[model samples]
Target chain A: MQCPSDKSKSAMLAYVLKQYGIVIALILICTALSFCSPHFLTWPNLITVTRQISLNGILAVGVTFVLLTGGVDLSLGSLVALTGVVAASFAHPGDYPLIIPVMAGILAGMACGAANGVVITRGRVAPFIVTLGMMTIARGLALVISGGKPVSNMSPSMTRLGGDFLGLPIPVLVLCGISAVSWLFLKNVRLGRYIYAVGGNENAARAAGINVNGVKLLAYTICGAMAGLAGVILAARITTGQPNAGLAYELDAIAAAVIGGTSLSGGIGGVGGTLLGALLMGVINNGLDLLNVSSYYQQIVKGIIIVGAVWLDRKHGK
Target chain B: MIIRSSKHFIGMFLLLLSALIYSGCNRDAAPDKKTATDGSRQLVVGVSLMNLSSEFIVLINKAMLESAKDMGIKLIITDAQRSAEKQVQQIETFIGQKVDAIILNPCEVEASSPAVDTAIAAGIPIINVNSATKSTPTAFVGSSDEESGRIAMEYIVKRLSGTGNILIMQGYMGQAAQIKRDQGADEVLAKNAGIKVLARQTAEWDRAKAMSLMENWIQTFGSKVNAVYAHNDEMAMGALIALENAKLKDKIVVVGVDAIADAVQAVKAGRLDATVFQDAAGQGRTAVKLAVKIAKKEPFEKETFIPFQLVTKENVDKFAR
Candidate 1:
């Protein structure tokens, strides 16, 4: 029989493969597309893919925490819409300082997230139902606030948040910052350890004196704030407070997390994997666009790839 | 076995044919649909709309409602809510109710047409509005999507002197507006061989998405794109944002469609070069008017086309109003 060390080493190898599979997939797609499209490997095209993926990347990082804690937030998309229009309303030309509108948008999402937490914890409602209901409410509120149209003409300074910083686009920088901070948070903080415990086994966590509800509330609230930040970035980038922005975005975020090998049952994921998953999605989109593939076939190809990824993951797990 | 199966097929076919004939002639039984016999300058017209949530569709609904009030016509409106099956059900309900005539703002091109056929088979005159159906109706009252694109392109060709590099921001692919608008742009491109198309992609009728797409194009082909032609105003407004950020606002001449309020403001401010006026209110009014005419058996044209006009800075006010 193999020694315990050898078995654990094999297990470690398996874990790494499962977790870093998305990175490998992204590299392969990039390599293939680099050969297929003459423009695919260029610096400008790669930057385009990174910036395009940033919004969804930040959202995936946020939802990754929620999924790790054995819950899902379906309201992220609508929350993005709500925060975006709110940010645009305040960020209108010379209306307010840039920070005020930016914070206002993030705070709105936090409040909405906090409320979702309260209902799920205090009211004993399921996370899916609570977030689903909030999804509709938030989308309707976005429509009402924006009067069923896009809010435009945001301040120039406000729009600059979506522009370049140093050498990189502000959104990609923001995405990088969020990912680093999230990685550290998961690695270092005491609450972070408690989060893993709570997700691993709620009853065991409660027995161990971990505040399960508090940890859950923290996860969901952070998810909300991230969603808000994403909203601000998109609105500023587009220079509009669009109520219709981020439609069905939650699906993409969830898909990224899942494709990155995050367990839906709880307690197994990280920002690194999520980033790779987001990059894979971004590369696929860029590659398809570069090849001038019709959006219809693009959708079909994307769906099949997602399904195939999950199927391979499941088989690997077995 | 072949003979037996054929007999079963014949029986099912006969059953369906008789059912259609029965439903056609005995339409007076349903308590919901009022017959024209009791009418005294009172007409009941049933209308099925695509989706009520869209701002443009809401404007269409408002115009129709206003026309209904002014003409003293009783209108029963059904919201299809973007579901083709729901639209089919609404059309069937209109048929069963035996309304004088039916107005259909189709949710889809083909799925919504067969139901309109059912209303026709029931002897109900149908008026199709805005988007077309696969099968023709008694009357069609709306501006063609292709015509909107043509008006925008014609103006662009004039401004560019028939030759310039341009970017095209499309709507949702396979959507009626996207296909027809691209056709119009392609027709213009075909004529002006000197006009180079730098890039074309579907932004899916989204402002934020379009803005990012424009930003990517800027990165890929900076300073090369001389103009932008968006399938809709939302995308145009987004392109305007990207251009303004890159300080290309003064260089590129951008045009769009729909003439939505924001686009109108953009045009008025001289930020957007031009936008094609889609006349949502006009389509709504004409649909109602045609429905009443068909109900009253008054003389009317089979198809009424609303003209799409280019809304440049010079003619912005007229289109805006």
Candidate 2:
């Protein structure tokens, strides 16, 4: 009943809405917050918000790869703790160079991620179950390694990772660098394309000569490494490697990815959208704190926004 | 085919769950088996701590272990892991074993009360340590949470000369410590007409969280914040770090409850203005002593209120050791 051009035009519009709607939602929330709180729009406050979201943003980007491959990494929070302890023990005053601790933390995370990948592929277990097991194992490992106490007395250089560099927080700069690189990889690389194909349809991807298992292994390893990096940053910022840190952090990262239009079923999302999602959450939290809103109400408001944003995007997408 | 595979998965899941549950129960039952093997007429006391992850709770646990060894008492200590239900189950296990007494570091005033009731009903004398439950125990040993809050706030008020904007960093919201500390702080604040509370929020008794919250508050309140009162030393340390980073520590007076080793050290170094001492060692030793007294049928005080002391630079040395 409609002309082909008109039909294609409507389809394109729908595609754009589904892809970039979260950005618009984020902008609207920021605009609203600016009207509510004078502090919300200031340069310093903006920098603070970015600094706060940097950890989650790094995590969200890492999980975006896993989500794109139809897998999930629930052990992210535990890995943060485990890697943090490993790094902090190495980072004590004059014990090792800053690179050693940073590398040790990330490598520890990568090893755990590789373990998750092996179990999921070799054992033929579901990602959810495999990751759930790793979650407990990693937490226990962190406790065992740290002796159930926070690791303190970190070197000044290590703690400087949480400070400013060239007028920008180092953590935020790390997030930006990671996001830029990830965006390029996902957009241009063959392995990255295979990630989408595998998640889109496993049998079809296999028929197309893609190494499905390898791609999944890579996805999980990358996620774990990101979690490791986040752990190091958190440890540096807090000036202690607390074994109990990063509780429920995975939930926030996953929420950010989901809010960015990443499907739990996979094969749909990118770094740009994920950054917007993390930014949206950061802005809301900063805004609420600036306005002196009760944390009880802030929790309720956060829940509503997460669900509402996703629901709206899905509805408009159709 | 999907349904059949799902059914297989469910069966496997159940098997794993049962294995986990079995291991957990075995861990709890190991001490009872050890007690039976001893076969000596040694008095046994089972202690259910609120959570051993906290440094303060660990201190209490360490002191309890030491005193129990000295007093020749067989102690079965279990970490409740912040779950009242788990604490109740642990008490029930202790009752089944017919321990001489039970010591409860309650997780909640109401939720943990059920554990007290179950213990008392089984004719077991339960000694509450560190915190309280709604249902009264045979004996209690701890400093008052409210008193610690009052002491810390009163110190801050005095430093500010009774006129300034202050911030309150709470612990885990709705916890016994959080509620009573807020109440005690309010009692002090209400009397001071010039002092005003600029903002209050929970960092969930976490250092990193408090740091982030403090950073945001610094951006929001800036120079207006003259003082900060944290529910615990960990949070106070966090706020102090944030203030130091922002180059505002010298201007702002910071205080916290629980004169933890680090807090005491900080006070001595002049990094922290003050902290209230809850005397974890005192509470732990007293609880063990009282439990032994109840078991031996010796007269003991039903309530032992260990006084909280304010730890400032002047008094830091006395508490540091």
Candidate 3:
């Protein structure tokens, strides 16, 4: 009886650490950086850090749902470039209403997402292979459409979307809004519940009359749509449609999800955790920049932290 | 058995690589043998480019292709795709064919030297173009990257009356242009004690990344940032755009290198304060012209350096194209 009671206490500790380690990491990093750089604690610097990480945060959120369904989408980065190029093509200065380019970009993303969902479900192919193919196709299409050059000279109104409103950057606002909505959808909605079920055990889910394919399809599509929205916002931020934009962004999104305690094996994650993960990444980057760390060392540091966090997560899973 | 291990995949990759090299060598041998039998007066030149994806390289390739045709020279052009290994293989093929001349646009200084040395040992004159190589070449035709940086900094130094807090937006670290330009700009900054560096960071020669970085810098330094100096026009334009959005464009002086078409337009429109000229076409044409001379065993200089020019509103019309 004493041995079993001690085992349960340790198990509870591990569970709490697994669940809340990312939040703790974020707080610790912020506290440490505040001491390293005088600017780290300031409001403007904090907002700047948030805005810098907003792109990664939005993308991390998009990928979180798919991970919950035991799927992956490697095409988010390429889709970002594609959506940005397409939207910027239609977003000349004052020529079209702000809503037109905005809608065009989101619709393009949704259309692409739908295609990804359709193929992954109907073809019965591995989600990894399908999305990997999309990564190449989307990147090639972006380069072809943009002629291997950047589309620049966007209208003021279009660029303004990347600017601030009500003393807050638009990207930060979008990230928060999306996180709120994703939380509600993932926590309260029925389809969201089905996602967890399918991810946990697909065969069991199918036996229980759940549409496992539909849940996966839903996850992949939403992931793609969010990637596209991030893309359009990025184009607005940069004021150009760069064919080479968002290179390796999918990896970052996946890293964010993993860091937030989203198991790659699936069935466990949340947007709230992912958002914290993104902020954790952002704080490290911003703090390093503020501290004037050499860029070469910066890469090494980032790589080590990423691997260590993932390794710890895996240990918890085992 | 279920995993279908990665070892087999690697084995297949090696087999493919060996096959490619063997075929490449055979093709080179076959072409040269035919040329020898025919005894044609056609001077075959091989051009190995660093990569053909960039507009600048495309322009250079076009110039080389057209000029080779005009000179009645048969040309074999290969795109290295930014791979040093691919470039070395191309050089090996050129040596196998005993081509009259080889034009090498190296991917890097150290990685490409051995291959170019092989060409030189084969008695083929290798002309280095645009970029410098570690091994000495028969000749080089390119502009001084430092001069472009110097011109841009000179303008900023004068504009600020030799004193201001400057933010330097650098390019991809470890690249030739990035290193030389920083050296040039920093030399000037060091001379003027009144000048202070607010922050310097590598933006990796990207406009969007530069813009984002600039936005942060603006938030950090704000009014104290009296000038913005970028390593190239793209970054300069990015900084300008960010500054405009932040409503801080009026007091700051912005300068950049690379008088690309967009940068020229920006200069014309008074958005970019100044840009220094880098003559890509001139360098391309000169490289071909000198490669022909070296191949023909005619008189040619070991080093032909092109000059860099400063472009401002004062002379924007002259270099607008």
Candidate 2: residue pairs that collide? none
Q: List TM-scores for all candidates, in order.
A: 0.85, 0.93, 0.85
DockQ for each model: 0.29, 0.65, 0.41
lDDT of 1 at A297: 83
Q: Which lDDT values do the candidates have, in the order given?
A: 0.84, 0.89, 0.83
* Top DockQ model: 2
| Count of residue pairs whose backbone atoms collide, per candidate | 1, 0, 0
TM-score of structure candidate 2: 0.93
Greater DockQ among 1 and 2 belongs to 2
lDDT at A306, model 1: 79
The native-contact fractions of the candidates, in order shown, are 0.43, 0.65, 0.37
What's the C-alpha lDDT at position A241 in model 3? 80
The Cα error of candidate 2 at residue A315, in Å, is 3.3
**Residue-wise lDDT of candidate 2 within B90-128, one digit each (tens)?**
999999888999999999889999999999999999999
Question: What is the DockQ ranking, best to worst?
Answer: 2, 3, 1
Segments of candidate 1 deviating more than 4 angstroms: A1-7, A32-46, A122-126, A300-318, B1-45, B72-77, B92-101, B121-125
* Model 1 Cα shift for residue B153 (angstroms): 2.7
On a 0 to 1 DockQ scale, where is model 1?
Answer: 0.29
A1-318 per-residue lDDT for model 2 (tens digits) = 001235688887786787657767788888998898888899988998999999999999999999988899899999998999889999999999999999999999999999999999877899999998998899888888877778877899999998899999999999999999998898888888788888778889989999889999999999999999999999998888888888888888998998988878888777887888898888888888888999899899988987888877787779
